[model samples]
Target: MLTNACAIIATAASAQIIAGRDASADDWPGMASLQTVLGHSLFHECGATMISPEWALTAAHCVEDARIETGGRAYQYARADDGSLVRFGVLSVAIGAADLRRRGAGTVFPLSAVIVHPAYKPEKPEAGNDIALLRLESPWEGPVALVDGLTVVPREDNLDGPPLVVAGYGRTEEDGPGEEAFSQTGRQLSAPKMRLQEGYVPFVETEACRQQIDSLVARYGLSDIYTDVAISPDSQICAGAGTTDSCQGDSGGPLVYRDYADPPVQVGIVSWGLGCGRPESPGIYTRVAAYADWISGVTGLQIAAPQP
Candidate 1:
């Protein structure tokens, strides 16, 4: 996600940590985090999902602030007190395993490079195609994708009522977002509550999603920013309700759904939305299934292991 109307008319960016219950740090072992570290200190940035041993998927905007390197070289994005983007030496991408809030719970990887979709338009986030791929320095010996069968729930205007799980190392409190969501401890902060959170939000119909966003657009007289905040149904999926939703840091994370006995398959990537956990406006995720062929063509790796 980009940010919101100010940045782009009626357009929403990746995410922000917001009101949502805490999920087990252990769930979704494939979950990964992109961070900037200083000495032994780590600052949480964006979330990513491991799609293969050496390849992963995330939102294009998530990597916009990052610099691409020649190799799996290290680069650091140091945040200044003024919140200005500061660079330290060559750009290095640090990847963490599961359990972000927990120290030593996840392992760090050297990111080789990141590839953003050429079709992605930052000025028009709602136009669709908000996906990206990352290549690690080496083959990852960690959790990979579940490809036993068709795990993704297709991007349809009417998915009816399907169960969905969204997990991220994003904001724990809806009101507290951005830098405030992170602790100020000089040392590593113990955020057991903020480690990794998951929410069980029902998949919403595309039309219903459009209606909610449109109502807001009409109510607030945002016709100037956007005439159709309806969001693209083929490129995005909607979820959450009332207080349950995915927030800022949740961007580029995974939206998984189980089909049967096989492990849960990722269907969506945290993309954008109006706000965190708004009653009518739910979180929107990039439909992973819709870009299967694109992902395969970009990364040259199967979305998952060959089905049995």
Candidate 2:
């Protein structure tokens, strides 16, 4: 029953992007923007930091169907074919955009290996440990930092009160589609801090999300089951309202705690949401703290302090 239900929703809606535009070097707190290219066609994807230069974290769903390529090839296609070759691994990374309207000055690197969470189930559409790690072919020689103080379990305190900075190159409106082109670096956008329901972990209401699921199945014929969970291990955060939401292309970007004095820590990973910030539909995110051990184990890096 759960499997069948999951299949129903998996067919609904298109992939949503959580981040949009590129940030000037000063916009992103510690790390510069991250850009990924995959496949021979070089489809562009977004991601953020777990540790600078060592491990880059993002959504596993982004790479589930990707092919690996190089940055040069990817960019060439983007220039020639637009984003038609985006399915390949061609990608570049840049940091500190002097002009917010344009791209920035960060190094573009090829992805050496993509290690996704072992428990990630594409068919479930639940965002369960939906996290992934990108091993850069070379170290980043820019301003990057690790997201620290994340726990593996949900905290009892209210995580919604603080003002969160949600940055990505996702579309400004839902279902409107993102920029038809790709860039070496991404932009940083912010959302007003909405209330996070810590105790009330909402599940995907099959009935509510049915229309989306039905359409997706009809068009893509996918068989994954989707739920309206506020936030799950799958890294999806549900938000609904109007234009104030994450859209297609924001996947794997960071939902950050930029209010901190020392460094802005990545609290969640943008995965999926219910209709792009619709009313009553709070945005969901992959809780970064809950997977600290798993991330550390996979990357072989020391966990940084949370408040530092």
Candidate 3:
């Protein structure tokens, strides 16, 4: 997830990568990174969910800066000096029936407009109801699934079981001191099931998180380390160390709960993690259930409970 503090820097790095690659349709994973472009150059970046042939759900912060584009293997954001623009694009557009994924098939349409949440506030990264809706230029012609609505999974009731799948493309580790590099793209990382909590979820303790954060800051002097101890109720699901963790570039990806007989249903959106996957740090996710009404109202899609 690109918090306000790290948004600018990450956007630049990502733009370079997006413009340099030739991504394919099949590479568009359900919950993948979305790169915004301006005149063939990457401008901004955010995570997106492929909800339907023509629709994607993502954080408002991502689209707040550029126009939406699809069909590329991956999304990239470029820095301002690289001639990139960081701004939202389009207001609203209907989804025309088209299938860009088919080989030898090329489809192009203009976005009508963008619909952002009325209450979305970018400053508060924790109050992560920062959701948004993108009306595709044309309706995608294929099968797409929507994420499931909020349904509580009791922490103690479900434990020592199968590992929950937390997927994203963020930094593999905390930003190191004197380090001036970003993580690679298209690399899907997973954290197995760890500890879960009902009330306040504890990430790596502040001291520990600070140690890593301080170390990076001292070396890099960039102050990129986000060692915040608490996550707001709106944005994160407290899952402690064992296996499950979130990292940079993972924002907007899904923290899915998969069942044997049914497909995986997304329970949360990758929002942030403590000190880049430290041993005790639990990754935070934007609570999908908290914004069910907002999500449904904006997309005109119903949020249903997943069937077992």
Candidate 4:
């Protein structure tokens, strides 16, 4: 059943990073670059977080076409109708490294399986339920390990909580000049940093978030693009400050809340937004806490309770 009440929202663009800083080598150990290999080139499509050695979490839209057949043993590949294999791209994960180009800095694992949430609607991303899990072909064998026992909790409505960090290899500019801007073909381009980029964005209270987005819709005359409820507070989290926000290429990445003296915990997954770093149009993320049980059910891993 569709758990979220609001399945339709406005301008559901994939998220990325805008005006973010470069991440250090030691930061975000669980950060995984979702890559696709075509011929001799490897392209970074989106971001993911390695939850376990063999399991990683990302957005459903990232691998929406990936299918696992009956008996859970065969992969479905595009065909030419002539019963011949159509060469395309292979999905994989590059983990343990902040910079993707550095050889030996990380290990790349081919995807064994991809499971998208049943409730997810590719056409209506703003309606919530945009999460997915990727099973690694094999367990990671690197020193950059993942921290287990990370669970999500409902964030308070107020802004008293600390800022969250969003990291990815997405474009650094949008609607502006230079390489990071969109192409004339209207495709969102990536002028990602050689290393992972990160930005600190404050949480936008649910009610305030909705109002601000509504104002944005009115100002830009986006009534045709967005519905009455642009953000579903129950299944989505809003976070952005100034020009620092998630935009294209950052989808499926983690929005981690790190408190002092405590291990960092991922609270959200980059889902959609109105525009790149627009005022009042905060980036929306899939609330991880809302689907905790679903994730556990799909991956068959017993998620630990959050510490008090």
What TM-score does each of the candidates earn? 0.78, 0.63, 0.57, 0.79
**What tens-digit string does per-residue lDDT give for candidate 4 at 1-308?**
01122333222234446878888646676788787655555656778888877788988777766665554432424446575655456777878656666535337777889988899875456667888889987787653323223343445543337868888776666533223333233333333444688889889888888888778768766576555344676677889855898766678888877764665667788887777777777887887777778877877766566467
Mind giving the per-residue lDDT tens digits that candidate 2 earns over 1-308?
01133332211122233233334345454332344434322233444553656457777666554444454122212212342433332444443333223444445465666776888775343536667777767777666544634322233443545556566554445534333333334433222111111111223333444344345435544433333323333334333323344544556666665555745556767665445544444444666777778887887766654342
TM-score, model 1 to reference: 0.78
> Whose lDDT is greatest here?
4
Q: Which stretches of candidate 3 lie over 4 Å from their true place?
A: 3-29, 41-44, 66-111, 150-162, 176-235, 240-244, 305-308
Candidate 4 is scored at a TM of 0.79
Kindly give the stretch of ten consecutive residues in candidate 1 with the minimal lDDT sum. 147-156
Would you list the C-alpha lDDT of every candidate in the order shown?
A: 0.62, 0.47, 0.42, 0.67
- Give one digit per residue, the lDDT tens place, for model 1 in 1-308: 34453543212244544554555544575677766555645665667877777787888767755665455464645447686878754322233444443334235566777777888864444556877888877777766654212234333434557667777766655545444233333445322134567777787877888888777667766677664343676667887764777766777878877544656678788877766666787777787777877877877754443435
Worst ten in a row by lDDT for model 3: 11-20
Report the error of model 1 at residue 192, Å: 12
By TM-score, who's the top model here? Answer: 4
Off by over 4 Å in 2: 1-23, 30-43, 67-87, 91-106, 150-156, 180-224, 227-243, 305-308
Cα deviation at 9, candidate 2, in Å, is: 9.0
User: Each candidate: how many clashes?
Assistant: 15, 72, 35, 4
Off by over 4 Å in 4: 1-15, 68-87, 142-160, 176-191, 227-230, 306-308
Question: How much is 249 displaced in model 4, in angstroms?
Answer: 1.0
Better of 2 and 4 by TM-score: 4
RMSD of each: 4.7, 8.6, 10.0, 6.9
